[model samples]
Structure formats: structure tokens, C-alpha cells
Target: MTLVEAQIDRIVGPTHHFGGLGVGNIASQQHQGQTSNPRAAALQGLDKMRTVASLGVPQVILPPQIRPPIDLLHDLGFTGSLTEILPQVANDAPELLSAVMSSSAMWTANAATVTASVDSAHGTPTMTVANLSSSLHRAIEPQQTLCDLQRLFASFATIIAPLPGGAAMRDEGAANHMRLGSDLESPGIHIFVYGDQAPLPHRFWPRQTLAACQAVARQHGLPPENTFFLKQHPETIDAGAFHNDVVAASHHNLFLHHASAYYRADDTLAQIQRRFDDLHADGLRRIEIPESELSRTDAISTYLFNSQIVSSSTDQRPTLLCPMQVAENSCAASIVQRWIDEGLFADAKFLELRQSMSGGGGPACLRLRVPMKTRELSDLKTSCQWSASLDRALRQVIQEDYPESLDRDDLTNWQIAEKCLAAARRIQDLLAPTR
Candidate 1:
């Protein structure tokens, strides 16, 4: 087992640990024109959540409005609470106000609603030339929201991959060129840039990513050799490939897959299949199921049979994490089903919320896990009260009377309730409060 996998086994006892997770509001007007269906986005979010839940960790939900969305999360069996923590309000001290008045009365004049003009000359006048209406800018920027969401879930020691520079700095190309320095201080934090092409023509992200990793190593008081850079095979930038890179790198193992040639759709599957075939041929009998199978039965069966045959030949067992798709399935939901079908993933209580976004990928693809010192399993059990409360809340929501059209097996109250109970129990155990 890789060091991270081992440590996680120790800390949460075979339960996986994911670090970044949040709920994205696809119901907003901004995404209406971009996606074919808003419900797909929501379904994707729920699916990712289910994936996280299946790992046996509390999937943290960060939404602007926490309560209403908690119902959907409950349906996915998330035991974590839906809570909002507003950013620290900027202080407007008298000295700061005096400075602002001296610099630009325009700002002071705009505050007239709060206070009458102090003096005609002393009072600031709003600058018509530079004044930007708040109404025009009220929409939340994805990057800023991501940073704030990271802060809110600091306890998870999460890191956020900022939106690609092109995505963040629409017009300022140079801004995107700025890479993270090699000496950052947050060990738990990592940034996963989305696009394949760097915002700037000459700049490469791998170099900057390496530097950031070094910084994280320094912060953790580890040697630079301890840090490694793992990138996706260009063609298979899908969730499974991303996670495999993370797991391999976390154990100080080099990713043998080449990104340039292995990412093609036809080539991607062939490459992955070949890798598994090679492993079997080499007498390495264990194989973990890729997360891509939740939606693809044929692929799952093929892999399972192949791995089982290989195991039988080698007298070693092959394990599958249960195939799950990051595109439309909830990690928790799929994982639960996997657990129900095969008992491969043990201790479903230590999984952490890794990454969640409106259009990118699931939690597993958003963050990377590093090997760390492990803790005893007994230290991880959570409280039963919270689980009970979550179950009650889910029951209340799903059992409510609604339009007939809204009712379906996927939306059944019983299914939601059962998942909620399982999630609550798992979460309470994972995040058990200290005495």
C-alpha cells in the first residue's frame, strides 16, 4: 500500500481522506446559457457528494444558502453539516475614514446614506467617471468564491486549484502567467489549475506546480525530495486518471503513464486496459477498480473479470474501489452501491471532501493526498446524535408532499432516509467530537 493509503488506514482505519468539497449553485442565471441542462449540474454535484460519502468521510457542503441545499445533500447520504461562514468584514475605523476622505471625497459622498454630508468641501463627492454600480458586480466570481470556500473548510486542511489564469484574468494575460512560488507555507494546501494550456504562451504550469509542492514540503518540515509533481495524461483528464496520479505520487511512486500520448479517448481506455493487463502479466495480482464504472456496466464487468482471473492465477486478491463516474454520479451514492455489491473498500468513515465545482470534476480530481503520520482507529468515531439529527432532517424533506411529476425512485423518501442514516453514522464516527 502507498504511504498515504497506509496512513489513512491507520488514522481512519482504511477509510479514505478527501480534503476539498463544496456545493455549487447551478440554478443561478449565469449557467443557464452555458450548460444544456441545469439539472445535470445539480446531479453531478450530488453524484460527487455520493462518491465522497462512499469513502466513509463526512462530505462538507459549502453553499451561500446552506439550509435549502442540505436537503439535496442528505439525499446523497452526506453526514456533514451545511454551514456558511461569512468572510471577515473589513473594518472602517475613523482614521481610515479620514484617510479616505482626504484621498477621495467621492467615496465619502457615496456614504451619505449612512451619514449626512460633514461639510460641503470635507464631504466626498461620488465620482461619476469611476463609480461602478454594485448591482452590476453583485454576481459572485468563481475564483473568489473558491478561495473563500477553502477558508471556510480550513479544518479539512483543504487547498483549492484556482481557476485557470485565462479563466480568472479574462483580459490581463500577464496575470495568468504569474505562477505560484516554490516556497509556500501551507502543507495541506494545493492548487489544481484546470486548463491544459498555460494562460501565457511561454509559461508552463508544471514548473510552478513543482515549486508549490516544494513549498508545501518545506512547510511540513520535510526534505524537498518528499514532494512530487503528478499530472494527468492529456487525453484522459478524466477523474480516474487524475486520482491514480495522486495515489501513485503520494507513495513516492513515479507515474509511468505519459500524458502527451495516453490521453486520447480511444487510446485512453486502451492504455488503461493495457496497464491492467501488463500488471496481471507481471504477476502483480491486485487491481483496484477505477472510478469510471458506476455508469458503465460493461467496462466494470470486464475489469472485474480480468482482475479476478489474474488474482486466481497469482493467488493474490485484486481490489476495486468500485467504478464511479465523476461526471454525473455522486461519489457517496456510487460508493454505497459499490460497498453493497463488493466489500472491497473498508472503513468508509475517513474519506474527506476533496474538490467540488460547478463544471470541472468530482472531489477526487480536485485535490491530492500526501502520506502522513497515522492515528488509531478508535480516535475517529463520531457522535450518534448528529447522525440521528441528519436522518430526521432528510426524512422531513423527502417525505413532504410534492408534485407527482417530482416523485421518482431516485427521489424516493425511503432511499433518501436510508442513505442519510448511513451517512450520518459514518460522519459522526469520522468526526467524533473530543471529550
Candidate 2:
């Protein structure tokens, strides 16, 4: 059965997908953004709201660094607040320092030291850099950082199976080399890692991560039939060099591939029309607004221009496009205007947020969703609120005890995560129906 089909079978359970909206900071930094500042924080909050509204899913997971302002969450109708987890770092070690640092240097210097010192004093050092830089570089390089960040965001809503290849195996040129397809199942999560020609050492490393995922599945007593692996196409040597060879190898129910063509002055409107025609023929969906159009100071004009095309098109299938206008101008008003003008997205829901410190992503990039019973939405909101309350309580506790017992080895990384997890579990259990 397809992953979506399997998820449908769950009448009542914790079946969900956890997507990582690509590294939020990467985009934010590229755009000269910061999440900590009040204005940026407010924008982040709006973005989170858009995520919930657009996806129609409540359990959106994000990096610990991405906490939206509480008021923004409330405005977005988020009954539940943000749940902050340690971002998944590239290192194999469970050290909290490595995990946080892998994603953020500032996090490493600030939170890592505190967590590490706490862990050490408690006779457990929970922070260590696993020397997985080589592997991390292979998996996500600087040029393809945006793609990696998107993959990270998607991972939160879907099971992200690490592809084979250690850090050395990543192909610097191929954007698709590091990502593996994810599946949403009822009893547990499963992901398929494919591609044979990843850069190096990391290519084979995905197997180990796969094994880890499988173990997690088994521990949950999920059936083997729920798991699957799609093999790589032989001719697919690099990411950029796409041939029908790789496309033919994709056996999953859905295949997502990226395609782009620049529009130059000489190109006529017919050329753009032909380009989209070719794309539809190839089963590719247009999800992002072209970056060129967004660069203009009149971003709203560009958005209107593009929206006209989308509005006129007869196709109803969802297309992925950055609401560049939304990114450039922090408002959903235009989107609503467009919806009214053409009755194009009238049926479609609209979610808009102010840009976050981690720039470039819209609602779609930050949140991941596993199609679930409509009831779960309420559950998610409750869980989110509980998490917020807990975070507030913890912050209060830390402040009250400030400078009184600031020791490095006081709390292990695992212990800290365990504490957080326990609190979440309690909230979850309270919401869950008792036998």
C-alpha cells in the first residue's frame, strides 16, 4: 500500500509525520535575517500560523531555535504552542552539543556549553562533536544548503530516511544526493533511501541510519510490510545530470523532482507557456515562484503577474511555488485579493506569515504533515499549548536558580531530552482516551 493509504488505516493512534523545514537559519542568514530580534520573532510567529492554516495540520515540528512569539501563535488560532526539540545533527553520537551545533554555531556556543556542563557534573557528558563534518558536508554542502534546509523541514512531517553515503559520499553538484523518500504509516514511520552514485563515504552510511529507523519501527511493533526500500537507478551518476533512467526507477506512488528554466528578455510569453507544458508532460509540479521575479522591488506586481497565469490555468493539481510576494511583502492580503480576482484559489485555503529570521521559506517549507483523522488537529493544538506551558515553566525554573548552580555536568543531553520528552508524554497521555 502507498504510505498515505497506510496512514488512512489508523483510526486512532499517534501516527504522524515529522518534517524538518530545511535549516531555517540557512535561508535567514542568506537573506541577512535573525530570529531572536522582536520583529523577526513576530514574523516567525506569523509564518508558523501560516504553516498550521495552510497544511491544516497542527503538529508542526521545528528546530529548537525557532520559537515564535506567543501572541502570534494565538493569532494564528494555534491552541497548541511550539514544541522545541534538539535539531537532528549529522553526528552519530547522542551528544546534545553535537546535535545543536551541527545546525547552529551560536547554539553550540551558548546552549551546548550549558547542557554539556550540566551533563558532565551529573557524571555524563552529553555534548561531543562527532567529527561528522565530512559526512555533514557530503550530505548538505554550502551551495545546496537551501535544499538541505527544505529537506530538514520536510523531514519533520515525513520520516526522513538518511540516504547511503557518509559525509564523504555527497556529490557537491547534485542537490538530490542526500535526500531519501519518506513514508507515513499507521503503526510506525518508514523511509526509503535510494540513489547509487552519492559522493562517497556517506553513500553507504545511509544503511546504518536505515537500520536505526527499522529498529525504531520494530520496537514499536510495527509490521514489516509497513516498511519498504526503493533502489537507485544505475545511470543516475550525479544529481544535476537527470536522465529518464532515474525517473523510470522511481517506483513510489509519488515522485518529487525539481526543474527550473530562466526567463530572459528574448523569450516570449509563448516560451514560458511551452515550458510549463513540457513540465506538466514530465509530471513535475511548479511549487516555487521564480527567484528572478521576486528580486524586483515591485514584488506585489510580480506576484499578480504570476497569479494571473495560475488563475487562468485549468489544472487543479497543487503546484509548489514560493509566495515570493508574501516573502517580500509580509501580507496575505494580496493572496486573498488574487483569490477573489480569479476565483482560482477561492476553494484553496490561504496562510500567510511575516518572514522569519530563517528567510525564504513560506508556510509550506516550515511544516510537514501526515494525513490523519480530522480529530487529531485538536489533539495537536492541546499538545502545543502544553508544550508552551512547560517551556515557560522550565525557563522560570532556570531563571530562579540562575548563578546558584551553573555546573557543566549537571544534566546529560539525553537527560535533558528525556525530561522534555517526559513532559510531552504526560500531556499526550492526559489528552489520550483512557482504556
Candidate 3:
């Protein structure tokens, strides 16, 4: 039973713009009201999937959700055709219009938290669609996201219903979760990082709740002994480390994070090391970037901790797929070189994700990883699989239909809305499951 981790990436939508909807993410706010190139943004995302596939790793595609969710507008007491509603909303309230036009779905890391069959009692992969109860723009995603997940994987995986309770049980999904094991085939230790266990001082409110993390563990049937819940440092969240992924990342046997990732970072690592050693004969590799070396401000700005650590075919250690910003940052570049010298990583691949990066996402944020058995992959639906043909087809659509550039004002244009809707539908059709 060979298990491999597959990168499930979502295609950037036609409405990709910088409305600055995210509350805690500093990058998103900093670039607010700027013009965005939807065509380039969507193409860059596809190119990333192509790059991941070229590395001899399995890659999967998740379709983007349709933008200008008019149903939401109708629910808000707007009555008319999409054209009529667009101008009405623009006149009545521009903020409400911006919320519906958000293209945040491209960052699929917040899509869901998945449990590999190796770690579950049922011996089948399980996914709990994130409720994303923190913000208005994101909160509207779960229903559509759940529908898409079910359509794609219902035959092979157990899709757990989103957690029921509201904001009190706010769930931000896999962005705040980490799993590490000796190998992909073995049972792993689950570390659910939450922002607040007890309310303390902070600049921004935490998105994930302790109750949500515990509920996900229970729903997935993860063994108690192998599961641990850790609290994110209050200061880190205030520093713009909105989710744990902003401060930490994990591969099969390696746990790489910043010193300020948790409230009690040293003790947390000790407990994780103990659990990892107990589960498998191999020990966990811990790499903690200290504040003296890289301040929390630098980590958030460069998105150094948001890189994806993936297994390499040519080397024993994994490769770091990081944003180009890290390579440009002198301090970040030096640390990455040090890691390579120490054999912590095989090498680093700098990806050009400026569009997504400016919107507060990086290489890791653009994906959702699912560890699947070869047998599971073999029997999986083919439409979601990545290949040269699918890549070409998606690129063509972006070139032909997606907007060259968009501003906040364009979000309220009915013609722009129509084009976006059509492009999303075309991509959705292209990735629809084949019988």
C-alpha cells in the first residue's frame, strides 16, 4: 500500500481582484483598490500545477466557484436581473457588491482538512469542508465548496458535513492544521493549531477556534493518542500570521516552523517529537526559525513559512516550493541556503505567484494536500487529474475569456460579471467528472 501526497490546486477565477476583503492579512490590505490582471493570475496558477506535475508528483485540479454570487444579493433584498442588481448594489452599497465578487476561492488551502485513510479508523480518506465562518466573503464558500468536493470525490472519500455551530466554532480548515509521520504509508500525528483557547490581547481576532479543531478530529475519527491541539501565539496573530500556515508547515517526517508559531513552542515540539518517535521508528526533524534570525514581521511579509515542503525524487530531503518574494529578500534567501547546506531541503524552487501573493496567499496557500493510496488514485475520477492537455485547455480559456485587468469599479459592471460567470462555467465544465 504505497501512499502519495497529491496537491489539489484550485484554478484562479476570472474575477481575481484586490478588494482587500481579508481582515487579518496585511498584504491583502496593503494592496487594496489596486488593478488586478485576471488573465495572468489564472494562467500563473495553472503554470504552477504544471510545474508540480513535472516534479513527478501527483497533481489534481479543483474548479473555481462562480463569482458575483447573485443569489447572495437576492437574499440581501436586491430584486431584479443581475444587471439591475449590480448597479443598484453599487449605488446602494459598494461594500456589499465587493463581498460577492471576491476571488478568494483560488487559495484552496482554506478549502478543507483531510485525513488520510492510513490515519482514519474507517480506512478511507475523509474530508471536512471548512465552514470559514470568520468573514462574510469566505463564509459564503462552504456550501458551494462542499458541493464541488462531493461531485469530485464522493465515490472514493468520505466527505464530512461542515461543523454545525456558527462563529463560536469558527473553522478555517487545513491552513491551521499540520500532520507529520515517518512516511506517507504510516499513521501520522495530527497537530491542530488554533488562535485562541482563552481570550487574550491581540490586534485581530483569531479565525480558528479550539472547539472547531477538536470537532474535526472527532469527526474524522482520528485516534486520541496521535492527535494534539496547540495554541497559536497571540503576538504572532497580531503580527499578521493570520493562520498557522503563515508561521509553520509540515511534510512527512519534517516539522518546519518559526519560534513564535505557538504559545509554548519548545514544549509543543517536545510533545510532538515524543509522539512521532512513539508512532514510528524514525524521529521527527524539527527546524525552528528564531526571531533573532528572522523577525515575525519578515516571516509574514516574505511568506517564508508558507512554502510547501515536498518530497523530491533525486534527494532524500524534500524541496521547498516558495514564493519569489523569499528569494528577493536577502535574509530569507540566506536562511534557505543554510537549510539546503544542512540537508534540511534538497533545493528551493522560487515560484512567480505575485498575483496570489499580493492577495495574501503563496505556494502553499494555493493547494490542499490529500495523501492517497495508489489504488485510490487509480480508481479516482479522471477530470480532476492534471496533464498537459488539461493545462493547455485551461490556459486557452484564460487567454480567450478572462479579463486583462480589473479594478474595484469593474466588480459592479454587469458585462464584466457576465464574462466572469461564463469563464467560471467553462472551467467548471472542463473539469466536470467524466462518466
Using lDDT as the measure, which candidate wins? 3
Superior by lDDT: candidate 1 or candidate 2: 2
Better of 2 and 3 by lDDT: 3
Off by over 4 Å in 3: 199-201, 313-315
Full candidate order by TM-score, most accurate first:
3, 2, 1
Clashes of each: 33, 55, 0
lDDT by residue (35-58, candidate 3, tens digit) is 999899998898888888887778
lDDT of 1: 0.24
Off by over 4 Å in 1: 1-208, 230-258, 261-358, 366-435
Measured against the true structure, the TM-scores of the candidates, in listed sequence, are 0.32, 0.33, 0.97
Candidate 2 vs. true structure, TM-score: 0.33
> 289-364, model 1: which lDDT tens digit per residue?
3535332232211111111000111212222232233213364255444643663333222221111122222222
